[model samples]
Target chain A: MTVGTKHTHLTYPDIDEAVDDDVRQHMEGMMEAEKGVLQAREQEMEECECKEGMFPNPTPGRRAFLLGAAAVAASTLPRGASASSGKAPAGAIEFDVPDDPTKVQGRLTNDDGGYGTRSQFESEARWRFPTKTKETSWTMTPLAESEGIITPSGLHFERHHGGIPTIDPKKHSLIVHGMCDNPKKYSMDDIRKFPSVSRQYFIECSGNGLTEFKAPFLKTVQGTHGLTSTSEWTGVMLSTILNEVGVQDGAAWILAEGADAAVMTRSVPLDKAWDDAMLIYAQNGEAMRPEQGYPLRVFLPGWEGNTHIKWLRRLEISDKPFMTREETSKYTDVVKDGKARQFSFTMEAKSVITFPSGEMKLPKPGFYEITGLAWSGRGKVRQVEVTTDGGKTWLIASLEGPIQSLCHTRFRIPWMWDGNPALIASRCIDETGYVQPTIAEINDVRGLNGHPKFASIYHLNGIMAWTIGADGTVTNAAHKV
Target chain B: MLIHWSKTVILAGSLVAFIAAAPASAQKFNFGTTPSAEEIAKIDIDAMPDGRGLPPGSGTPAMGKNIYANSCAACHGVNLEGVSAAGGAALVGGRGSIGTPKTKKTVESYWPYASTLFDYVRRAMPFDKPGSLSNDEIYAVSAYILNKGKIIGDKDVMNAKTLPKVDMPNKDGFIPDPRPDVFNYR
Candidate 1:
C-alpha cells in the first residue's frame, strides 16, 4: 500500500510486511547516515537570527506561519518532520523543495522510506505535561489545529504509567485465565484468525480537562481539552474470545493487565466485555503507533482511556474490581463530604471551541467559522449549542455528518464578530438527554472541595468559554468558582 | 398513515423473527490454545484485596528500613515525605487531610486497602527499576512504609496473612461512582 502526499497532516504508517522485507537492508544504511549530522536546524535557519520565538519572523514566503504567526521558516533546510512534541515518526524522508516547484522535478516516487509523513510546514503536534518522570507523563493533542473528527494517529493524545515499550508482535500473546473454565492464550496471529469488526470510537482520559475545573489556568485549548481522540479501530470482539474459553458462573469482573515496566492493571465489568470491548490491533487503517500500544491494546468503548490498557498481556476473570493503585489512589474522586468515588468509568459530554480559542488572536474577525469538537462517553452527541455571549443566549450549531456512537463529532457555526469583547462557548446534549453543565453546576453537585480545591476533577464535562477581545485576542473565560 | 404503521409493524415482526432464528451467542471461535498451568502462573502476578494473590513471604519493619533507604528513599524521602526527584506524593502522613483543601494523600491517608499497598509496591515501585525487588523485599517495604505512618506496630510482621488483614485508615473512605452528577436545565 502506498500513501501519497495527499493529506499534508496525516501520517500513513506503511506497515505492509512485503515492503518491510524489501527496504530492510537499504534502510539500515540510510539510518546510519542520519546519525551525528548535528548542525542542521540552527545551521540552516541561521538567517532566522531574529528568533521571534523559536523560529524567525517570516516576511512573506510562509505557510507554517499561516497557522501560528510570523515564523520565518527556512524551507531550504532539509529537515525531518517535526511532530512539535514527541519523537519524530518514521518513513518521512527529508529532501529539498525547489524554490519554484514548476522549475524542478520532485524526488523519485516510492523513495520516501516506504511510508509517508505529514508536511514539514504543518507543525501541529501533541505537547507533553510536566510530571515527576517524563515516562509517567502524558501529551495533549494540538486541538487548536484540528480540522476533522478523527485526530491523526501520530498526533493522538497519550498517557503512560511506564514508558512506551517496544514489543515484537510475533512474541506477544494475551493470556486469559481466572474465573473461566478453560483458560486460553492467543497469539497475535491466532487472534487475527477470528472474524474482526471495525468501529469509530473516542478514548478520553478521565483527567482530560482536570486543570479547568477550578479555574482556567492552562492557557491553550490543547492544555484545557486535548486528551481525547477518535479513531476507527479494527479488532476482534473480546466476547468472541470469551466464547472460546467459557466464563465460569458468577464471573462478573475481568482484570486486564499490561506488560509494560509498570505492569499496569484495571478491573473491567463483564457486561462491558459483552457490550463493546475489543482487542484492537490496528488504528486509522494501520497498525497502532508504538506510543499507542503498537502490537495490541484494549478498546473499551465509551470508558476512560486508562481502563483501555495498552500493551495488554493478561486477563483474569473474577467477581470483583481489583481496586488497584490507579483506581484507589489516583483516579478516584475526593469529594466535599470526605468520601471518594471509585470506578467512575464514563467521561460525560464535553465540547470546546478550537478556532479563535486560547492564545490565538483572531486577525480582525469580520466573518469567521467558529468550529470545534464535541463528544460524549455515553453515546452520540444529539446536539451542540454554540454561545457567543458568555452563556446568555445559545444557538444549535451544525453537526458534521455521519455522527457515529461514542465518537468525536465536529460542530460548526458562522459568526459575524462586531469587534466587541464577547465570550464564545459550546455545550453538548448527548443522546442520553443530558446537557453539559457549567463549572458552577458541577461544583454544586460534585462539590469542588478537594485538598487542591476542585480535586474531584474527573468526568468534568463543563462548558468551555473563550473570550474574544476587541483587539481580536481569544482567552479562556473560565468562571473561577 | 395507516399503511406506514402497518409496514412498521411488519418490519418489527421480521426483526423479532430474525432475533429468534439466531441464538444470542457467538459460535465458539476456538482459535485459542489452552495455556499450561505453569505459563498462566508466570504472568498472573496481580494481587487483589483480602490476601487473594499475595505470594508466600514474611518481613518485619526492622528488616525494611535499609531497603527503603537504599531503594525507595531517593524519590520517597527518608522521612516518608516524597522528594521532588520522584515526583510522587508522600508515602506517609496526610492521615486526615485528603478531602480538605490542605489535602496530602499518602498511602497512609488515602489508600483504602493494605493489599493495594503491597500490590502497587511489588508491581511498580522504585520508579526506575520496577519488578526488580524480591517478594520478601516487597513485604518488608510494605511493612516499613505502614509502620512509618503509624498504621502498624514497628515489630509487626507483613506476610500474606498479615498484609490483607491490616486495615488502612481510609478503609471505608471510598464509595461507588454516582454520575450524571449534575443535570442540565432547559
Candidate 2:
C-alpha cells in the first residue's frame, strides 16, 4: 500500500501493519524537522553587521515612537523576563523589537534543534477578562487580530471550571459502562487503534457573549466573541466504542464525566452520541494542549462547550439524565418569568465583524475590507450580510471557500468609508435558514427582567454593530438595532 | 390517481426495505476490553438525581461544621460568602433574588436538587484537594450548607435515600428550553 491509499476493508491486521507503519514513518519525519520552519536558505551566507548586533533596522522615526510605546507597555508587563531584553537576539535571528524589518529580509533555514514557537515579532496576546479569579475567569482570544478560520491551538479561548488538569496519558483510561452488554475500558492505545477520522469543528461556550445580554459591556471584539474557537479535531467516533460495547435497548442518556477536579458531568442524549459525538485526542494535527483536555475529550459539535467534557474519564449510559451539578446547578439558562431553561444544548447561529470593531481605530479610512467570522452549531453558515447603514441596507459578504459544517467561516466584503460617522454591522444566515437575531428582538422574546438583567444570556448570537466616527474611531453600537 | 399512487407507494416501499436491510450487513470492529466490577467501582463516582451511585455513608449537619471550617472556610468564607480572590462562589444567599437585577444566586436560592450539592462537594470542593473528602464528610458538608441556607433541618441526615428525597426550595425554577424561542426561526 502506498501513501494516501484508502483502506476499503480495514481489519485489525490491515491497520496494525500498513497503518501503523505509515503513522510511524509520518511521525518520525515530523519529529526530525519539528520546528515547522517553512523557508529555505543558502549553504552559507556572510554574517553581516546586522546579524552580529541586535538593533531594529532603523526606520526614520519608528525607533523613537516604539521606544515611547515600549516604555508604556513595560509597566503593564506581567512578572517575567521582559518581552524583549535589549540584547536578546529574537525574531528568527533578527533584533528583538515590537515591529522588526528583518522579518521581511527573509527567514533562516528550517533546521532548528526541536520544537517551535510563533515569531517573536507577532505580539498579539489574549486579553484576560477582569474577573476576581483567574481559574474561573476566561481569557478572550484576539479575534480582531486573527487572520484565519482556525485559531492557533495556543490562542484558543479557555474556560475551565476547576482549572486545567494535568493528566498522564499512561495512567488515563476511559471506562464505558452502564446499559451495555459488555462494559468496556479503553486505554489511549486501544482508542488510537480504532478506525480514526479527522474533522474540523467549532466549540462555542454557550456563555460566549453573556456580558452583552443587557447592554454593550466589553470594549473589544475579542471580549465579545472570543469564547468560540474552531479546530481540526482528530479522533475515533463515540459510536465506534458504543457499538463495540453493544448498547442496550432502553438507554436514553449517557453521562460523560471528566477527570478534572470538578469531575464535571453532562448528560448527552443517546441520539447525539450516535450522531457526531467524537472522543478526540488530537487537535490541529497534534496532541491537544492540557488546557484543551489533552489526552481525551468528547467533542459534541455544535453543542455548548460544557457538554464536550474535557479530560474525559467515564461515560455511563442510563435511561434517565444524571442531572449532575454542571447540568442542573450551573449551565442551565435562566430566562424571564423567573424560570431557567434546561437542556438548551445546541448553540444557534452567530456572526461578528472582527475588524473595524470596538477599540480599533482606522488610520484614515478610504476603502476598507469589512471582514469577520460566522458559524452555526446546526450546520454550515449559508450567507453573511454586511450592513454599513445599520439594518437599512445589507450586502451579502463573500464567504471564504471550503466552508464546513459547524466550523468558523471567514466572510469579507469591500466597503468605502465615506469619511463620516456610520453604523456598520454583520449577520449570518445559517444552513438551517436561521437568520441571526438582533439584541432587541432576542431580548423582547426572552423578556428582560431587571433582576440578573436579561432573562437568558447563555446563547447570545445576536448581530454585533459598530459605529465608525468621522475621525476613524470605531465603537460598539450594540444598542442600535 | 389510484394507479399512480400505488406505483409511487411501491417505489418508496422498496427504498425503505433496502435501507432496513443495510444495517444488518453493517460492520463492527468490536474494539476495547470488558471492565471488571472492581475496575468500575474504582472510578464510578458519578451521583445521579435518583441516588443510583451514592456510596454507603451518612452524615448530619452537626458533624459537617467542623469539616467545613477547617478545609472549606478559607475560600468559601466563614459565612459561605465566597472569597473572590480564591475563585470561590457565594454558596448561601440570594433567596427571592432570581428575577431581580441584583440576583445573587446561591445554593439556598437556586439549586433545584439536594443530590447535586452532595455530588458537587464530593467531587470538587475544598479547592486545594478535590475528590479527597470521604462520602460522609461530603454528606456532612452538604447537610451543613443546606441547613445553614435553612433548606434542611440541622438534624437532617444526608444519605443516599434521604438526600435524594430532600425537596429543594427552587425545585420548580427551571423550564425546558423551547428554543428557536428567539425570532431566528429556520
Q: Pick by lDDT: which candidate is best?
A: 1
| Residue A227 in candidate 2, Cα distance off native in Å | 0.6
Whole-model alpha-carbon lDDT for candidate 1 = 0.77
| lDDT for each residue of candidate 2 in A76-120, tens digit (9 for 90 to 100) | 433222333442122222232323333333333453446665543
- Residue-by-residue lDDT tens digits, candidate 2, B3-104: 999999999999779767767325555566788999999888878778889999999999999999999998888998877556567789888877565555
lDDT, model 1, position B169:
96
Regions of model 1 farther than 4 Å from truth? A1-94, B1-26
Clashing pairs in 2: A450-B101, A451-B100, A451-B101, A452-B100, A452-B101
Question: lDDT tens digits, residues B165-185, model 1?
Answer: 897999999998988788673
Question: Model 1: which docking level applies?
Answer: acceptable
Clashing residue pairs for model 1: A56-A72
The C-alpha stretches of model 2 lying farther than 4 A from their native spots are A1-111, A450-455, B1-26
Write the residue-wise lDDT of candidate 1 on A22-132 in tens digits.
Answer: 133322322222111112322323444232211111221233223222221443333322223322323232234444545555555665567866654444556676665
